[model samples]
Target chain A: MEYLLDGFADGLMRVLRADPQVMLAAWVTIKVGFWATILASLIGLPVGFLLAMGRFRGRGFAITLLQTSLGLPTVVIGLLAYGFLSRRGPLGFADLLFTPSAIVIGLVVLAVPLVAVFSMTSVASVDERVRETALTLGASNGLVAWTVLREARFGMMAAVLAAFGRVSSEVGIAMMLGGNIEGYTRTLTTAIALESMKGEFGFGIALGVVLLAIIFVTNLLSRYIQRS
Target chain B: MEVFFLDNVKFRFETDLVLDIERVTVSSGEVVLLTGANGSGKTTLLRVMAGLLTPEGGVIRYKGEPIIFGKPGLEHRRKVTLLAQEPYLFRGNVLLNVSYGPRARGMNISQANEEAEEAIIKTRCEGLIHRDAAKLSGGEKKRVALARALAAGAETLLLDEPISHLDEENSKLIVEIIKELAASGITLVVSTHIPEWASTLSVKNVRLAYGRVV
Candidate 1:
């Protein structure tokens, strides 16, 4: 056990010294996670607001569908995205298979429902009079929607943070869709998996520590926002 | 000089008829008091006039021009404002809440702040300008909301039970402010259960029962 601890300490020192391989993997993880979160927010914020506020048929069903999708398996998403982006597929012309863009697309699919459902729930929880008051104060329809969004901004931010956390830690989509290519698509989770399989437990533990730190910071930020 | 004219207006919610008024006209710069018991449709009438709720069937005119339900243009909407019994303030300081209307209407921040500060001063809430609007007392929130409506420069103001939960001092201050706004040629439609407000403003009283003018 002491030997293991010593190896972990040594591995952490190497990581602290900024190993190029680990740094490259961290960069890819950050880029893929941020882009996926951005795409998800762009698609989710408006749809979620409409789901919460618009009077329409099938709104309940749409919300239920999105809510049910929150627990979707990462591997299933990876496989599905792989099918769509693989050679001879309808979108094969893009040649995006095993690329960071493919990983981003898969992660976005996983994140959109999370951001959407949370945003809808948050917007729905806003005070009923907020819309009426804004409208009565001479705000246009667009402005009323903006007001609702502003009121729910914190919840929406939490949703974004949650999406980033999920995609950044997910290994299935990164391994399958990203192909975990060295210096290109390799991410923290996939590198950890590879290092562990190769009996490099110390290096894997170091990566695991970094991943845990990221999750901790994300959760901390989310909790702070919720409290404020 | 008429501000609003409603003829044959009918509003239904689900299967129940809520409001059915044959005719009511509000002239410019007049204080019209709306008094009715609970569920008597006084609030519904104010809401319809504010363009927040659409009448199922009606011929409504604003300044002698036909005003369509659900599509009252921004300019027309800017000319009218409503204050519910319990008003809602956005998540911000008093200054931000008061400046919302002008900012929503595309006014620059500096100009909107100027108008908002002026309204806050007029409503006697200048001391609370930097305070969190959501944490204010009932009377202060109402006053801030009224100041927001004032900042909009609305020609017509519809207030529903503005002083319902206020103390005597606050109530008197609001009444004086309303009187001053009326004196400035702004049409006021105030709904309340208190008889003193109508008498205090010396306004014409219009009563409603079962959605009909009495």
Candidate 2:
């Protein structure tokens, strides 16, 4: 118990002192998580909006498929991405395996369904009268769609924050896809895993603290947006 | 001039027939009052007239040009606006809500504000101009919604249950506003459940019973 307390104190000191390795891992994590979340939002928001508003054959099937994807394990995504990005694989020409970009690819796969499902819920919750009101006010179809999206803006933001939270904290994809390469592809989650396994509990705890802070900040922003 | 001519128009909700008018006409600059009991299809008829709903089968002519059932042109929409029974104000201040119609029609912000202010004054909602629309009382929301429709400058207005839940003073104010609107030669089709309310306005009455003109 004393040793654990010492390790916790050492972790706090290292974080306060801005240790170089911890800082580099944090920066890489932010960069990869940011890019993955942005790419996923760009693809997911519109797809979710269409799924919520559009009426067509097989819409129910598409929603079911999206919901199922939300529960997919991150390691499975990492494995699939590895297969596609590995040398002698379909995307081997890009030579992106064991790199930060590879990790980003995996994280994007893990985050898209989350963003899409949340966005669909947000848009679907808007009052049906909004569409009718816009139409009666002489707004074109495009304008009506824009109006609905604006009304659902906070929910869309929450979706983005939720995606960021998921991608930032996930370890499976970071480890399998990034190979935990130091000074290059290393991320906070991967570093935490590697450090703890190598008996570097202080360093692992420091990175864990940073990861928790990132997730905490995201949740705070989401709650603030929802209240506003 | 006949502003709207509906012939054999039919509308349904799933399998339930809602509006089935054999014939109806509204001449330009006329006030047509639609009075009906609950579920008598008054709101549905107004929605069809405003080109917001497509009738299952019918020929609707606007200004002598045929309005295709499902494809009411933008021009048709711009010239006709509907005020719902429970109007929805956008999430913004009253000025922004009232200016939405003018903005949607491509007016610049300043010009739209000018139109909105004029309409707001006319509807006696100038005091609520800077107030958030979502914070408005029920009567205020209705008046602000009317101001929005007015700012659109449409030649025709379709109001559904305009005085349904208003206090006596507010109801009187709305009736006076309707009179003023008619005097200005804007075609009006106002719906109400009370037959006595229709008598307050010099309007031609169209009574509905179970989706048909009685």
- TM-scores for the candidates: 0.90, 0.95
> When only chain A is evaluated, what TM-score does every model earn?
0.95, 0.99
Q: Which candidate wins on DockQ?
A: 2
lDDT of 2: 0.91
DockQ numbers for every candidate?
0.63, 0.73
- Model 2 alpha-carbon drift over 4 Å, by segment: B69-72, B195-200
What is the C-alpha lDDT profile of model 1 across A15-35, one tens digit per residue?
A: 788777777888898899999
Give candidate 1 misplaced runs (Cα > 4 Å): A1-21, A56-61, B71-73
Compared with the true structure, all predictions reach lDDT values of: 0.88, 0.91
Candidate 1 lDDT, B63-156, residue by residue in tens: 9887654535556677888888888899999999999988988899999999999999999998999999868988899899999999987889
Provide the TM-score, chain A, model 2: 0.99
Model 2 per-residue lDDT at B198: 54
What's the distance in Å from true for residue A81, model 1? Answer: 2.0
TM-score of chain B of 1: 0.96
